[model samples]
Target: MARIPGRNPWLAWPAGIVCAAVVATLAWLALPMVPVVVAWVGESLRTATSPPVAAPVEPSRAPLLEIAESDDAIDCRRLYPDDLWVELAWRPEALLSQDFSAPSTSVASLTDALAPQVRVTCRWRFDGGGGISSTLARVASDSAAVVEAALQGEGFSCETAGAVLRCRRAQGGAVEEHAVSGDLWLSSVETGRVPEDYGARLAEGLWGAG
Candidate 1:
């Protein structure tokens, strides 16, 4: 055959085969890291796309003694003595609801049948225990005798102590009823097991605070 070309076509076949082998080796070496690369890309995308979360908030409640003041319901703290170590226990709205129905004979009859149309009523307890509860009710000055008789019929020894009506027994229970304002009565009861004349001091404190 004549020398048609400087290099034969068969010589070029070896070079082509070697180039194919190198490409195949590189692809086989990189196959194991494919999962790692995919995982890194997924985590980066998640971190960039996710939003930040916020914390929760708390609610506020109005103080029991600082509610709106009116003729019927004055501020409990304003009516409470400052020097006394007693605290406002409950709100008048919770305890002394008014009832126009007939009254009950028993003082403990706080149910609807016995409940009075009290305007403002709140409980205050001493630091150690025994305390007094004060209530404001509507009673005319001319009807003082009627109030006295009612309390006496219930076993309370009521007597006119100056401008106020003092009622109690030697065993411990006591009460103070005074006309704080025209046709407005303030009554305080010192529950059983308190010191002697505690009701008087409480009454004086109420007087000063009011």
Candidate 2:
């Protein structure tokens, strides 16, 4: 094979390929890194020049006057003495009240939901400041059936007249049970000393008051 007059074929071809490869490598390293270098330099300048940031503030909460009571029973401790106390005396002014200034007062409070309704079981002397202990119970309600059953079962002769459960113990004393609504029972239990027909008056106030 004869060579052409001004042509060095192998040298020319290889020189061109080397130049292309070098250009490609430089482009690969420089072009993609340009934006990244510029961003880093700008961020560094901004960080060095910018002011310090302040911390965020938190919101304040409102103050409470009293703690809330649980929804269970009507806790007497949480309530005022008067709120829990209600008239339980018989026709207070009839005979007892006429004789005594304050009368052997009858007051009642309710209990927890487990033992629902009002329960009145005590003989308190209001004048002597010796009243029954606070019993957190529901309001008393008079149900003839409930009253009759409870009294009869306890060996007492009982009858439900109107909204009252009247029970006479074998020995003496009157047990007058009254109610406002539901099955709540407020009983005016007396061993003795308490005059007869007094419970009827005491029970009158409680009956249907709910």
Best by TM-score: 1
Give one digit per residue, the lDDT tens place, for model 2 in 1-210: 897899889899999999999999999989989999999999999999999788887743211102111234333222222222334343233222111111121321112212443222333454432232212134333344654555566565655565445555534333333332234444444443443344444443334212
The Cα error of candidate 1 at residue 191, in Å, is: 3.8
Best by lDDT: 1
List the candidates' TM-scores in order: 0.41, 0.32
Q: Which lDDT tens digits does candidate 1 get at residues 1-210?
A: 776778877988899999999999999999999999999999999989999667776643223223222344554454445544242333232222232222222354322322344655656455445555666555554455655666676676766654556555433444433333234345665654444445555555543222
Clashes of each: 0, 15
The C-alpha RMSD in Å for every predicted model, in order, reads 18.8, 19.2
How accurate locally, in lDDT, is each candidate? 0.51, 0.41
Tell me the deviation in Å of residue 171 in model 1: 6.0
Q: List where candidate 1 sits over 4 angstroms from the true fold.
A: 1-73, 85-105, 108-117, 125-131, 170-182, 192-196, 206-210
